[model samples]
Target: MTTMTPCQSLTIRVYYEDTDFSGLVYHASYLRFMERARTEMLRSLGLDQRALLEGAAGAPIFFVVRAMDVDFRRPATMDDLLTVETEVLAVGGASLSLEQRVSREAEPLVSAKVRIVCVEAGRARRFPPEVRAKFERLLPDQA
Candidate 1:
């Protein structure tokens, strides 16, 4: 199996609601777009978050963002077509690191590194074996 993970991209059309009074996209709006892209990234890997969040046998599983570092490099104005690209950077026993970027074609608007941790019963927990195996496939070779 290939160790490199392909970047996942989600297109977003900047709307009036996503913009501030200055007509530029709001900073929080980028967060929303990035969140959706990351969710889609997991979905593309065959991990259904809705089902996982609902859980089976009353075992609720969820992923929570542990930290995030964002860089707002450029601005995206209203009606801009933006794409959020996401890639897995690393994986741990209970945490995953990801890099995400927002761009308008060739112009980068924002970049972020996020750390997410798996949780069960409101505490950090090791990912399930199935989930671990799936994410492992996306991890780059340690060597």
Candidate 2:
């Protein structure tokens, strides 16, 4: 299991492609932002997905969204510099709970709790020991 902690911030500028009609970002785009933030966070921790999939283990790991709860607090306008903040909420045997947020000027525009199940061998499986060992290094005291 995991517990909440301060998140590492990833700031991205909103562009036209991220927006829809009325000059606001499309709701689904927030998910992409959060995904990128998480990916970069892992990279900073040296867990490169590409290498992980093609390494000596030769096992591919992908995440499948299992559950999501979102709240649209405010609309994100074009050209806004937004930040995605992610925190690990809990780690199950085969999945993890994450809290992701999209913010502008430090104010939250959207927030979500996302649950993703790990996939290996084209099927859902508990995270392997190697993966767990790598992730544990990034966790807080209670992890």
Model 1: number of clashes? Answer: 0
| Residues 34-142 of candidate 2: C-alpha lDDT, one tens digit per residue | 8898887666655667776664335777667889899999999889999998777777788877788889998989999988787887788887677655555545554
TM-score to native of every candidate shown: 0.90, 0.85
Model 2 vs. true fold: TM: 0.85
Find the candidate with the highest lDDT and give its number. Answer: 1
Worst 10 residues of 1 by lDDT: 1-10
Cα lDDT of candidate 2 equals 0.78
Return the top candidate by TM-score: 1
What is the per-residue lDDT of model 1 for residues 1-143, given as tens digits with 9 covering 90 to 100?
22235567789999999999999999999999999998887877788887888984146798999999999999999889999988788889999999999999869999999999999989999888889777777665632
Candidate 2: clashing residue pairs, number:
0
- How many angstroms is residue 130 displaced in model 2 relative to the true structure, after the best TM-score fit? 2.9
Instruction: Give per-candidate clash totals.
Output: 0, 0
lDDT of each: 0.86, 0.78
